[model samples]
Each structure stands twice: as structure tokens, then as C-alpha cells.
Target: MFKVPPRPSTSRIPYAPLPNQGNDSGATPKASSPARSHRSSSGSCFETPVAAPSSSRRLSYAVNSGIKPSRPSSVSKGRSSIVAPAYSNLSSAKKPGEDPRPLKDKAYQADCIQNIYAFLESRGFDKPFDAGMLQLPSSKLFLKIFEFVMKQIDPRFKYGNKPEDDILDFVKGLHYPYNLSRSSLQQAGTPHTWPPLLAMLNWLVQTINFSDATSGPGTTAAQPAHLTPRRFEAGPLTNLTSETSPLDEEGCRAVFFEFMKESYNVFMNTEDETISDAKSQEMMQLFTTYFEEARQEVALDVENLKTELSRKEATLERMQDKSELKKLQEDKEILEKLLSDLIKETQRGEKDLQGYEEVLLDKQQELKKCAEITAGIQEDNALLCKRIQEQRFSKDDIEHMEEKLARRKAVLQMLKENRMHAGKEASKVEIQKVKIMEEIGQAAKKFNQRAAR
Candidate 1:
């Protein structure tokens, strides 16, 4: 999940990085391509062409070098322009004397260069020479030259009109010198043009070195051009005519050959750095990956530990629950034993209370009998007193007394009848009291009833 930008900084490489940090400073990236051992090799990363070389001049640059590179007055490729069909028609109205092919091609290259230059300028890109401290380096000069030459080949450059003076002005403004026209390059020998002239000389040396490798029309067994992806060529153009001005051919060739030598040195210095940078970036990513994996492992271990801890805790809780249950059972047994002892003591106490209640009941019956005997004695004493305290009576008193006695006898007979009726009511009340006493006795009876029986 770490993301690199559209174009990572030259100092760093995210994928397939160089060794020992981004020290690689070579303009051309190395070709790590495997040999195409088979045309139908399934492992090939790049597609196989149907034909190895279709035409003899498939990638040829055939133009004469006699004329100044034709330049349109003002190259405006895809610029803000209203296509005046009228003007095109008027220009087309020319009397069929001119070859518009070269014109169109020159115009296109100018436009392309202008666009590239404009784009580079707008983006704060220093021109080739200024980039290297106000003097164009050989590589930058070569790249520019390559771009210029490619314009003749790239069909897409044919979109504008510009003049050759415009190109000269562009060259003049360059911080480094390119040997074009001595007038354009030296500028009346103001002594300030030497630096650029020196830069042009540097390029010239490179051009000669490469030119030496190539045998021109005079030689046989010619060595092949150093054809790499970097060199702008479709294929070798042995028969191709050079369209560049003959005046400028030597300068261009000299510059090109000079760059080749410089390029050899530059590649030597920067290849190791680029490799080192790529390798360092790779290590950074690898370290990041290792750390992430370690974190995941740690997280997994933590989760496992937590799960194990929870299991142990659950077991502990179960043990605690069992212990509590055992304790509760023991308490329940103790309470049962205490309750049994208390119940036995309470039963004994209840038996003693019943015995006391029986004794009390017997005493109450004896007291009732004693009270009845005392009442009988008192009645007998009152009778004896009545007999002794009687007074003697005369015959008339005696007769009156006898008459009173007869009246008393009559009253006594009436009383005897009333007493008989009263005795029946008392007997009924006593029977009800005996029945209530029997109910009470039954209620009070317990094991004593069986014992008494």
C-alpha cells in the first residue's frame, strides 16, 4: 500500500531501484532486456515484430545537406490560430513551382522544438547550457540536437511556419555555443562568445569520434553506428541523403562525435550511482514490508494470548463457583443439624409443660371439693344456732305460733315445688358445663391420654 508518484524523484526509485541510493545520473536508462532467443518466446516482455527489417531504409534519414535547414517564419503547432482557409487557398494558388514537402517538414520541426522549449521554459526547466551553470553540457546539447534531427523523421512535427533566423536567435540566446554560422556564433568576436564556442568545440569532438567510427562514401568495411535505443534512428540510412546545410554538416557531426566521447565518460561516472539509488529504494520498501509483517505477527500473538487468558479466567471462575456451591452445601448441612437439635429440645420442653398442666388441673379439682365441704359445715352450724336461740311461748303465743307455723308450712310446700323446678334448670346447666369441660380435656390431652388409658 505505499504509493509512489507519477514520476518519483530522480534521487529515489521505488521499484527495481538502483544500488546505494539514487546515484544513477545517466541520461539513458540501461537496457535490462533479455536476449530474444526465440521469436515466439512466451517469456518475452516486449512483443515480437512480424519482420526484423521490412525496408532497406525503414529507419533512414535521407536528405541533402546543401541548403540551410528550411525554417518556417513562425512555427505554431496546435497554437491559438484561426485556420484561414482563404489564406491557405491563396498560398496554394502558387503556380505549382514549389515543393511544399520540405517546407512543411521544416515548419513542423520548428513547431515541435518551439513547443518543447516553451514547455521546458514554463516549467522552470533550465535550458541545456544554463542547467550546468550557464554552459550547455554535451548530453543536453546532444539531446537538443537529437530532437532537431528527429524533427525531420517525426511526421507529427509538420504543423507550423517559422524562419531560419528564429532558430539562430534561439541558438544565440543559448548559454552554450554551437558552431552554426561564424557570424551567428561568434557575433563580431566580442570575446564573450568563447564560452559557447568552447561548448561547440566540446560537441564537435564527440561528433568526430562517432564520425570516425562510421566510414563515409569513401570507405569500405565500415563499422556500424552505435545503435541503441537512445540514438534517434529508425535504422541505418546508408543511402539516405543529408538535407542539412553542407556548411553546418561538419559542425553537427563534430558536436555529435564529441558528445559520444563525453557520454562514455558520463555513463562511467553515473551508472554505479543510478544502480545504487535503485537498490537503496528497494531496501527501504523491503524494510517497510518487514516491519509490517512483524506487526501483524505481534498482533496475532496478542490475540492468542488474550484468548488463552480468557480461557484461564473462565476456568478460574468455574472453580470459584464450585467452591461456593460446596460451601453452601456444608452450611446447609450445619443448619439442618442445628435445627434437628433445637427441635428435639423444644419437644422435651413441650412434654414438661404438658405434665405441669396436668398437675395444675388436678389441684384445681381438689380445691373445688374442699370449697364444697366448707359450705356444708357452715350450713350445719347455722342450723344448730337456730335451734338453741329459740324463745319459750304462752298458750296463746303457742297457738299463734302454731298458726304461723301452719302458714309457714303452706309457704314451705310452695317453696318445695319451686325448688324442684329450679333443680331441673340447674341440672341442665351442669350437664352443659360438664360437656364444655370434656371438650377442654380432649383439647389438653396428648400422649398423656394414651398413658392414662
Candidate 2:
């Protein structure tokens, strides 16, 4: 439902001669009557006012009076108070208003047209389009173009009885980014209302192009190359490879669906069995062509993948060998450094061991001397015991013997302290010697393991 402004009155309106609409003499037509002239002057008060062409009588009156009917100017200084009629049937007679919408840039329109045609051509659309088609497309041509575009988007999308409503619904469903009015789509045949439709189609074209580019083969979301449906494949037709051009999987599917639909319709509609048989043969031939093309494309892809895999495997083998060799060289250098450090440590240990050995020998000699002193003390005690047993004693002799015994005991205590100190020194020396031996043994074991490696 469209809301249109009221039509302006034509009474007392001026009739200005349009450019190149004058007589052969190049003279402007003058009003024959004073009333006509007065009316023309009175209409000049309004700025760029458009009057409805009421009937043929008004046009005849202007022609007989030698005054031309006014023609609307293509350009206007401001918003002209003229509006197109609501009904498309009266579109030719109606004057278009000064559109609030800005004109599309010519460069931008040309680019969009070019892109749309390029996309259509890529999709194998047979019909050609010029710039004029978008500028002032007929309803029939517009619908045809729309159907083609929608079919490209979805091969099985069928147009219903109200194609205009269907198209509007489909565009609305897509959430088209621009303003699209139902009125504009309803009167799509008119030049004044066709721009939005053209823009919508261009947008659809761009969307399809973007989707194809992003989701084509080799992308993560692309369909598997090898998944060709057997139902869509060629039947028993021969000479498959010679007849068809290469087709992608999607193309093959679309072609097969169309072929089947057409075949089914022909079979159901035709009363003649011979015609049905011929149509079936043609469908078979068409199917074989698409099937072969798709098959060839899949084969080529498989071969390319195989070659790529082999190349990668060869590269991996080379890299693995080089990496392993480099690792071995690094490990060998590490082992050599460890062996050199161990050798240095072994030499240091030997020096420390020699020093420890010398200390041990000194301790042993001290221990032996302490043992001899201990033995001498024991023998002296024995001799004193024997003397005590053999001789009677006076109190002065006994006191004298007690003093000697106390002095000997003091010597023996000094000897025992010396011996204990020597034993502690010996134990410390033994511990050091054992630690040195263990370290030497461990270093030797590591050196032997490295040699084996």
C-alpha cells in the first residue's frame, strides 16, 4: 500500500516550451486568447509546479492555441511540489516529484553493474544486461533477473504466485542493509522506483561473490572434494570426457537437479511415449556431461593432493635426518665437556688422595708410638705389683711407693689423651679416603659409559 500526495490543480498553470520542442522557425508558441495568456502569467507565481494532464482536450486546446504544454524539467533548484501517481498504469502521465533520496553516484553504479554482470557470467547466466536495464527495467525483465539471482543463491527456490511479495520477503529475510519499500518493489517497472531493486540485486550479487570466495575449495568450511553423490553421476552414456567442461561439485549438483526436474515434467506431461523417450535421452546426455566434468575435477584434486603429500613426506624425512644428526653432534660435545671436567676432577682427587695418604701414614706412626708407650706403662705396673708382693714395707717406704705410683698414673693419663686424639685423627682421615675413592669410582664409571656410547 503506497501513500501518494494529492495531485496539484492544472487550472491557470503556465505552459512553457521545452528545449528542442519549438517549431521549425525556432519561435516560441504564444497563447491565442487573453484568458490563456493571463492564466499562463498567473501560473508563473509558483516555483517548478507540476500540473496533472487532465485529458486530451487540454492538450488539444494548447495545440490549437499555439501554446505548448509544459514539460517537467529534468533538474530542479529545490524540492519540487510534484508527485508520481499511486497506480503504475498512470506512471507515464504522472510527473515525478523531487526525490528526497540522493542520486546514486554514476561511478559507483557502473562498478556495481560491472560486478553484477561478472558474477552472472561466472554463474553461466545466458541473458545479457546493459546499464539501461538497471536504470529503467521492465517488470518482466526485472523478475527474470531476480529469479536468476535467487536461483544462483539456491537452485531449488521456486517462485510463487506473488513473485513481488516473495522477492520482498526474501530480501527482508536477508536483512538487507538499505531501505527497501514495498511500494518501490511493486512498481519496479517504473524508472523512479527501480533503483532500490537494482541496489538490492547488486547487494545479493556481492554477497554471493563473497560467500563463494570464502567457502570455495581448500577453505576450512569447503565441502569435501571427493564427496560426489552417486545419484547425480552419469548413467550409461559414453564419450563423457569429450563433451563437458569442468564443473565444481555445486555446479554438478545444480545441473543434475535441473535435469531431473525437467525430465520428470516431460515424462508426466507428454502423452506421446516417443517424445518422453527422447527427452529422457537428452536428460541422460546432459547428466553425463556434468557428471564427467565433476569427476575430472575431483580426479585432478586427488592427484594434486597426492603429489603434495609425497613432497611433504620427503621434506619431513630430510629434516628428521638433519635434526637427529645435529642433536647427536650437540650430545657428543656435551659428553666431551663432561669427560674433560671429570678428568680434571680426577686429577684433583688424586692430589687430595696423596695428601690424605700422607696424613694417614703420620697418624699410623703416632698410633704405633702410643701403643708402645701403653705397653711400657703396663709392664711397669706389673713390675710394681711383683715388688709389692715380694718386699715387706715400712710406712715411709709405702708412702714413697705411693708417690711413684701417682707419678706413673699421671704419665699414663697423658699417653691415653694423646692416643684418643690420634684415633680421632685416624677416623677423619679414613672417612676422607673413602669419599675420595667413591668419587673416583663414579667418575670412572661415567667415563666408561660415555666411551661405549
Q: How close is candidate 2 to the true structure, as a TM-score?
A: 0.27
Task: Return the TM-score for each candidate structure.
Answer: 0.16, 0.27
lDDT of 1 at 300: 86
- In model 2, state the lDDT of residue 188: 86
lDDT digits (tens) for residues 1-453 of candidate 2: 101111113332123221223333322322221111011232221111122333333222211122112332221113221111111111112232333322355544555566566666666777767655666778887888888887655455555666666675555334343456668877886767765566567667655544343232212222233322223334322222223344745545534444433443453245566766665656656665655666888899999999999999998888689777899799999999999999999999999999999999999999999999999999999999999899877899999999999999999999999999999999999999999999999999999999999
Q: Tell me each candidate's RMSD, in Å, in order.
A: 49.5, 39.1
- Top TM-score model: 2
Whole-model lDDT values for every prediction: 0.40, 0.52
Off by over 4 Å in 2: 1-103, 128-132, 217-453
| Count of backbone collisions within predicted model 2 | 0
